[model samples]
Target chain A: MNERSLSTTTRATVPIHRRATLWDRLLEPVLGVNACFIYVFLYMPIVVLIAFSFSASPFSAVWGGFSIDWYIQLFQDSEIARALRNTLIVASFSMLFATIIGTMTALALSKFQFRGRNAFETTLNLPIVIPDIVQGISLLMFLVLVVHLALGLPTIIIAHTVFNISYVAVIVRARLHGFDRRLEEAAMDLGATEWQTFWKITFPLIWPGILSGALLAFTLSLDEFVVTFFVTGPGATTLPIQVYSMVKRGVTPEINALATLMLVASILLVTLSILLQRRRSS
Target chain B: MEKQRERGQLALLLLPSTLWLGLFFLAPLGIILVISLVQRGGPVAWQLDGSAYVRLLDPLHLKIFLRSLTLAVLTTFVCLLVGYPLAYYIAQRPPRLRHLLHFFVLLPLWANSLVLTYAWMVLLRPEGFFDSLLHALGFAEPISLLYTPTAVVIGLVYWYLPFMVYPLYGSIEKFDFTLIEAAHDLGATRFQAFRKVLLPLTMPGVMAGSLLVFISALGTFVVPALLGGDKTLMWGNLIQQRFLSTPQDWPLGAALSLAMMLFMSVGIWFYFRVNRESA
Candidate 1:
């Protein structure tokens, strides 16, 4: 889900053949139409949700008159605010810890050939393919049976950091792979120590990756629900938890407003990540 | 002295994550394996036992497991069917438009699955967007599509199409179209060229995308919890129910978690094996 990972892969990509074959000419329009329909299928639900957020009446199937009443209600709701605050608290801390730890891991993997490198790489990737249920339930069981930590914000932070570290490492590792290492070599050859070389040459070059990784880590921590749901204690409900509870009651226009707001925030963060990706490549 | 200094720097670079993942990630999973083997007697006491995993053979639990598999398979194939063409289209576009289209495909993912599933509920509910549209198109009745197995599949596909598209596009973009051209130049039929050349070359991506989409859709909680009614329980919801809800069957839940992990390990191992073989 990290845009940096997706867009970075496009940097050195080759474009397709331009000369149209007769077969292509016959097939292209059909495929293009199907693609357009697929895009609509993907996006139509979201557009409807946003439009309905402005509905004057709650839970009405008909087009209720447009109004900002739901927005006003959303802002005034303290529980929602508390949940948002909790989400931010967890996301910020998770981002900070995951970034520092993950960037170091990425540096180690990229800069040195180590024993058990492949094993460590696979270990780090467990989060990517492993189900959230495993991560969440295992963490919960660990906290309860062994660590005896409260199922509160701290536990949530731990769970998020565990997964976020891998994502951050992957992003930073991708960046490290794409970056030129000769600059660091040049710095070291000029009588700079390894430490100085890293600070002067390596860190600056990979800083964008680190920043984007941090952003992705933050965004992922925000977006997570399953693991957070399991580990979160009472009084520490995150926004997704709050949304789930509200949704269980019924889909109110208030949730529509909240989903819209969160999505807009996601768009802005994604735009920032893509911008950071551009900066990294340039 | 230089070698020692380099070693120290490497240690500094590696120790934090090594310890963090070791203690937090690996250790917790290890603990789950242990917990799954133990019997929960009192609130705080557990005895070494292996019966919990046996309970995983319960018909209800087995049904959920099968349902999870069925939904995941459907989601993966549907995503591949839809996403392959989209990825192909994006890959064939001019560079500027390709980026824009790629950005759009990733946009829904960025918006998060929870929100999108909610949107799906809104659209699929009785007299909702789909129903209204169908009515306007001359259908006389409202059909409730939400809270069904079909709705669950739709939700999974909606959220996970990006996972399929990303890997597929990666492969498709790297493919050499000239080989296909050569096939045509040599008088191979279009179908023949596509089957022999393009499909074989892009097979890795297809497999990669399917596995990515499958693994995710298999373990998804949100899509099932909201869109899949109580009748349509899945592995994720089962795990949640056992741990967080009335059951609180820690051992059984842990066993289920371990089972899910086992499934993922096989998928991931296969995934790496595929990539390694292709490379």
Candidate 2:
């Protein structure tokens, strides 16, 4: 390590021209322009969507006086209300289950060197890599055929949890990587039991991870379409499914308003999660 | 006794989740594989038949598979082309500002894909923003970009760009800029230095991001449905139609799923092989 360090230090000390060459000068502005273009590409649709949401025009393209009518209309729509309720219910329950299960899995994987550890790890991670369409169909078949379970809200929750578990576990496990085991060991060496030590010490340390993971799960389940679409029965329409059906019908300003609101909610939650993770690390 | 108790505790901790995954997650995949092999006459009637795999060989189904593959490949390529420069630009930013920049990159990713697709629909459909803009710019006809394969690819590339950016950012963030300077000191051209040093170091990210985009793009359902419409049918739409709509062929759906899964497995195997060789 010191040998490599010596070479690096010497290299650092060497006098090298720090002036921008022609290529650097040429490339910097080009990269800047490209970055600006990419940002526009990323954000223009969202800006336009939000802009059109407040447009009084029924058509997305037609501009008219700004109004809150579409948002008010969304509130009056009974289908929208039902879909919102269903989405919240699914998100909350799925978040809770996924967080608990994933936290437990993360703790076990990080703390133990047990038999089947590799197998268990791989099994947990499989859902992340498996295509959502495949997972959706597979669960649909199993629920309908093998298990003969009803296609309803519960099935949707379970389907969402399938992917959510892996996501939460991965996030929590990443947070656990830098955890110090000695604190738990020391607590145990004292009068504290393993359970006591875990609750008082480890739980607080990993709480940020758990919170962010839960938030992520909640958002994912809320936005989940394909899997929920597969497993859902009639009258169990979540917001995405509702939105999808409405899109199939035709274009509407109400959808623009609804999409804008959903976008805001997701961005807020994701920002909160990021802040939580950052605060924990700092 | 204490060691045994500890072992038991470990088992207890792992059991519930392991069982949940095994029963609900792994079991469903197994069921799909088994269903793929069996023949389904109706909802109730079933018999073992391998003809589903053979039926996938027909020209129409094969075209669907090829179309999905082509779209996914195109999406991955376009994402890489668009994302790499952005990743590099962000990676070159000051360390203090990197997280904020990364947050911006991840913002859209965390947004619902459905909502984003709807936004794209607003932009690309007939008389939509894109068409209107083109018409204002002296285009004679309404631009029919939406409900086409190109629209599907655009939507996919947009959806998956952040996935590519994050991994490439991870790789580029850790890259030592001094190495490129050293190559420059040794009289190498800027392009040569980037090609020799930066590219090699970041290959892992490129491959990982490409695979992530490719797999998702291949299996995406909603984008094609909303953007590609009925004509630009992909493997995912075909499978969805088979299961949920006309002909309600479960075995065929399963077979198509298995075929996709098999292709993914091979891709993953090849990924690991390359990774190992590189290591």
Candidate 3:
């Protein structure tokens, strides 16, 4: 009877064990392979470009030998230097405007109950959902018609700020969501004026949020292409526009070097932002 | 008195952003809508007409829209298939390593898109890296991969895959593995367990990622312009050529832009509806 029960129990569990093992054997390798293949696919082209940037030859596709001549050449290119200056100007000014406006918006949304709050929220999020092309076209048309704003640095900065404000607001508002309000209340209760309390208590706490938001806005505006493409006038070409034009005329080794440097800069900024955010949260 | 002061304070805080958005974003969109109904005379002139809207119903524009839609849908599908597994693997990683993996996934976005596309050009051009590798592997001939629809799709997927992966990772990171264990305990097979439990649980990520990828893919002009040679002009290129190229058909471009916006709203509505039901 014991033997019979053991055999029945074995029969009951055997198929399930077989199925589980079979599924794992089939799927585990497939999943691993898929994951590895995707990683390679994602990084290979980038790696190829970075490696070829140092080639002694002018042709990017064919590597000759190791040399930094392209890097030196990139520094001497007057047009690229001008684009870089334009890019920095737009990114910094736009970042400043976006941060101030966005922080205030975030503060208002978080601290108060108001009429049309939902409408305001939706308006802020609209740019995120709307296609970039639509945004670019509409903004271009508006600048050209209603404002008669000349396509130049100012227009580009304004366009960048328009979308970037929402990004900044969202990030700061996320910080405000978990904020401790009692400290501000305590400062108010202890005879601190509203403005003074804000300067002393609240601002210091959300300072990280504002800084990170500024960084994000800077990064976005620096690399913004589509809208800038629409609004940019002669002598106002940003790095991306310059890069686009260069790519159109067949990439030179100088561009490859420039691209590699830009990639490294972007990675460094993003990593710094991540570290700042992590430090704040921790 | 306190409430009044609070209201004033809030208004003071909100005014600048509101004014900026109103003057720039909302007003521009309104102007575009009006421009769509007007006839283009030249770069700076317009006549009140609706020829652009009428032209959209023509077979040619409709075909372009359908083609863009098809490409977007395909790109989204491929991204989902590739991104879901990658995100799942990343989410399964130890917590300390997950952040690094996520950063790696997003590294491409930090790099300029034009440069990224140029990299692909280097890899896929005639006698390029991909061709050379294949040739070295005993392949007799190089593949004509550049300036093709397949090349365009590959570039789009590479450009936007991180957007998909990030959202999926967000949703999947919060996934409850206990339910899978429960299914296993209930004698369901692994396939049945995943289909019944894991898939349903991660549907939100799938929808979110798909929506993000689809809209962006549909609106992209650069990928197609760079990778999709002259023959494979999508809707975005059509809109671009209208405004920037010969003829400068601003009205038609506005109409096309509005159509895309309308389509996006519909997609977003459907997404929210699905999201609410799932919630």
Model 2 CAPRI quality? medium
Q: Sort every candidate by DockQ, greatest first.
A: 2, 1, 3
Model 1 backbone overlap count: 0
Best by DockQ: 2
- Of 1 and 3, the candidate ahead on TM-score is 3
Per-residue alpha-carbon lDDT of model 3 for B22-82, expressed as tens digits?
A: 9999999999899888877775356789888997778988888988898899999999998
lDDT of 2 at A53: 90
The DockQ-derived docking category for candidate 3 is medium
Against the native complex, each candidate's DockQ, computed on alpha carbons, is: 0.51, 0.55, 0.49
Can you write out model 1's per-residue Cα lDDT over B25-135, one digit (the tens) per residue?
788899888878888655324688888889999998999999999999999999998888888778777667887898888888888678889989988888777787788
**Tens-digit lDDT track for model 3 on A1-282?**
243343333223324444557766666577778888988999988898888888785443456789999999899999999999999999999999999999999999999988899999999988777777778888988988888888999999999999999999998998888889998999999999989998998888888888888888898888788888888998999998998898889757888898888877777777676666655643
Q: Where does model 2 exceed 4 Å of error?
A: A1-24, A58-62
Candidate order, lDDT descending: 2, 3, 1
Interface RMSD of 3: 7.5
The pairs that clash in candidate 2 are: none
User: Scoring model 3 with DockQ, what do you get?
Assistant: 0.49
Q: Which of candidates 1 and 2 is the stronger one according to lDDT?
A: 2
Model 1: lDDT of residue B167: 86
Candidate 2, A83-146: lDDT as tens digits: 9999999999999999998998899889888877888888899998888888888898889888
